[model samples]
Target: MSLVEINFDGIVGPSHNYAGLSLGNIASASHKGDTSYPRAAALQGVAKMRGNLARLGVQGFLLPLPRPNHALAEALAYDGTEDRALRAAPWSASSMWTANAATVSPAPDTRDGKCHLTPANLVTMLHRAQEWPDTKRMLEVAFGNGDHFAVHDIAPVTFGDEGAANHMRFCEGHGTAGVEVFVFGRPGGKFPARQHEQSFRLIARRHGLDPARCVFIEQNPAAIEAGAFHNDVVSVANERVLFTHAEAFADQQGAYDAIRAAFPALEVVEVPSDAVSLEEAIRTYLFNAQLLTLPDGSMALIVPEECRESAAVWKYCEAMMASNGPIREVIPVDVRQSMANGGGPACLRLRVVCDPATVDPRFLLDEAKADLLDQVISEHWPEQIDPADLWSEALTTQVVAARTALLAALAITELD
Candidate 1:
């Protein structure tokens, strides 16, 4: 099998709205109560995947998990009596940020030589707590070929696990064994530490990873307090390179030393805090960019437009490109809608290294599939979703119909 990395991005959902659900997510909190454009959000996401398909030649997408989750609403017994946040929880489009969907250990890193994925039992907040079962079901369908893939139930709820947003892997190439870093946080603060240390330990064991190759590190407490909710918000790793802000970890040198001990060929592309402060990185999502190994053996950083708009961030990127470093290209894409919802390019995807043929083709994106997505989203997705509109039965029906239409178009009967 020709093993390669496939980024399974989430197609933004029809119920995309700004309910300001995620705590410690500065963007989400700041945009709460603002009207959101669902059609535009989803289209922007598709456009991103299209760019990925062109660059990598193979792009897969995870469909929006069934939303306006009536089961959750019924379980909460939400009869218009609870707080607005509770009422809006059932309709949140947060699932479109697929980084939190699961944590994956590619075939190269696992003992069984079969790629393993664990759906995150996102028990952090009420809005996201109800997502795992549906997320797991969707994953099972996407990676159902038993011979090459294994999707396991999350090992468990108590210790919070926010999935790939907090995890990074390093290796010489995508097809080789790598060091997996599970970044967890120290609790007791204004904002809750989402990825508990215990949770990642559970995930590491669940994936049957070699303990020697797994490095458990602590995210900088200051970064978390500064609204750097996940490690990806402060750092990102791709193949042999680790691109990071200076203050991304509690013990920056220690983190580097640990990684080097396991993989000696590690390349560090450190962005100085003098050029861009921690506050600037978090605000612009400078580190949340996707560091990809392009098809021709060059590396590119897929950053949000906000990075270009910022003088400091852009200057740093320009210097990095001119320095003859591993990162050869700096490409900026417009994911403004997702960025406003506390997700940049990285948050919209879950990366898996595997043979594309082993995946259910319905999850992969081709030109015709792109066109179909544009049409379905344009026709069935709501043009604008006001915070108050989430309560409308008409909007609920539209959201359900839009997802069903997408499932039908893809011939994904399991999700339907």
Candidate 2:
């Protein structure tokens, strides 16, 4: 059986705004209160999806979670009357970064012969914490094929589950059994490690992964202090290739050795510290680039346009491509709207490896459907959104109407 890894990217929402809600994200904090172009952001995301479908031939899409999170405000007893509550609600369009959506264990690795997914609690950050409920509903509706998929609620909030951003898998192919690596951060640093060790262990156990095939590693404190808020900031993996920076983990050699022990065929590509400093990696979001295995069995790096803009990063990418490495091509995508808010190409997607036939058709995308979605975004999405505009009753109504129209167009009434 041939299995493919499908990238389910989140459609950027009309509520996309730069409220600077992500505390440790340097870009988010630096660009606080800046005006955001929601229409452009959504279109950019759609365009990126189109590029993937056209170039890689394997692309899936997920709708944005309902935003301005009114339920959270009501839970906090703010009643939406005061501007303080409205603003404090975070109105987070952060759901566009679906890497934090869930941790998925494909059928090949699970004991039950069914794909398993656990929605992330995202409890460490206030804005992200509200995502689980809606995220759970979305997953349930999209992956409702009970014979092939199992969706579970997030682990306890105390466990601090940040989802796939802290998880990665490696194997010979998408259909083969793979080793699941869960990277967790300890709480002794200047910046909080959003993923907890307990949470990682709980997820591995819940997924019923074989003990020998599961590995747990710690993220480097220095990296966290230097603004590597999540493991993806420093490392990323696809199939048997692990693309990472030199200072990404606490015990880099040990982590690699452990992975090698489990999967001896693993290929480790470490970009040396001297070539690209951790600061440059974070600034350019080099590790956040999607390392994809193309239809012809070659690999390509789908990176944010910011990578090309950075002199050192772009030079490194060019060298990597020229060196005849595993990555055959470097495709630059324009997601500057998401980049400013601290997300890039990899951040905008969730990877699920399975037979396409097993997933709901509504969740998949093709060139024609992508074109229709792009048209919907262009016609209905708001042009600009300011942090202060989130409280207006008119804006709330507009957001609702836009999402309702999109759901109707997609024939997905469950979310509506």
Candidate 3:
């Protein structure tokens, strides 16, 4: 199997806004009711995709979900007199964080000799819970090759499953067999723990993954209380490298021991709490970065521009890189719009390990496709979206049309 890791980034939707619908996300809450720049956000996302394509040699993208999704609004009785949070739920662009799109077990680890995916039943928040149906629809079309891929329906919503954000894979290489880690959180925390243990167990069974090869680890309650809403917020893994915060797991050493036992070659690069507190880590999203293996075989940490600005985070990054660690380079990109809305480089992408040829041509992104995205997003996406604009009929029409234009451009009407 000629497999490689392809990052499918979500195109920042025209209805992108700072609704602060997520309770555990500090950035989203802090920037609530702020003005959002949809055109700039989408353009920034495209630029990031272009950069990754240049480094990784291949890239893919996921289309934005239909926004101002009045289905939920109508079901909830949207009568203009509803609360602002409830009103913004329909227009929330949280779907741009593709890390929460699904949990995937690549072919190398599955019994069927085919990659498997289960869309997340994100039942934790009303805004996010509505994503699975649309997300599953897109996944079906993108990875429709039955011979290479098996995309399964989401597990029951009774147990919250926030998808790949809380999951990590360990392997010698993208094409090799490896251990999969499912990070579940305990209750009685300051915020609701979205990833349930049962949810991932069901996903593993559905994907036909060996029970012994899958490690169910507990996310640090301290980290979650300190605003690390998802595991990606405090840790990220790429192949054999697990770049994480010292307090990322409930039993940090035990968590390491478990994974290292499963895949002994695990190279862990842990950032201590003294070097950078969990609060600083969450605030700067230092761990919520794309830890990518470049074409040269060296690894790079694609972080947000905010990491560069933070004195503590930048200093730690410089020292770590200077130490000649597994993460050879630290690259920063401008994704401040997404950062404010509570996602970063890793959050914007879904990492699928497979041969690019098996994927639908429409979903694959190339230089020309990147150019098209730049043009369409720049031309059709809204320049500004205020909280009040979510209620505006004209803005809804514009948001809907902008996505339609992009779908038409990509010739991907399956999503529309």
Candidate 3 local Cα displacement, residue 163, angstroms: 0.4
Whole-model alpha-carbon lDDT for candidate 3: 0.93
Which candidate comes out best when scored by lDDT?
Answer: 3
Q: What would the per-residue lDDT of candidate 2 be over residues 223-324, giving only the tens digit for each residue?
A: 988888989988999999999999999999999998998889899889998889999999889998888888789998988888899888888989989986
Q: How many clashes in each structure?
A: 0, 0, 0
Candidate 2: residue pairs that collide: none
Q: What is the C-alpha RMSD of each candidate to the true structure, in Å?
A: 0.9, 1.4, 0.8
Question: Which scores higher on lDDT, 1 or 3?
Answer: 3
Model 2 CA lDDT for position 287: 91
Model 3 deviation from native, Cα RMSD in Å: 0.8
lDDT of 1 by residue, 1-416 (tens): 89999999999999988889889989989998899999999999999999989998999999898889999989988998648777899998888988999999999898888999988878888998888899999989999999998998886687888999999999888998889999989999778889989988988887889999999999999999898999999999999999999999999999999989988889999998999999999989998988999978999999999999999999999999998899988999999999988999999999999999999999999999999999999999999998878768899889999999999988999887
Instruction: Give the Å shift of residue 235 in candidate 1.
Output: 0.6
Taking all chains together, each candidate's TM-score versus the true structure is 0.99, 0.97, 0.99
| Better candidate by TM-score, 2 or 3 | 3
Candidates 2 and 3 compared: the better one by lDDT is 3
Cα deviation of 260, candidate 2, in Å: 0.6
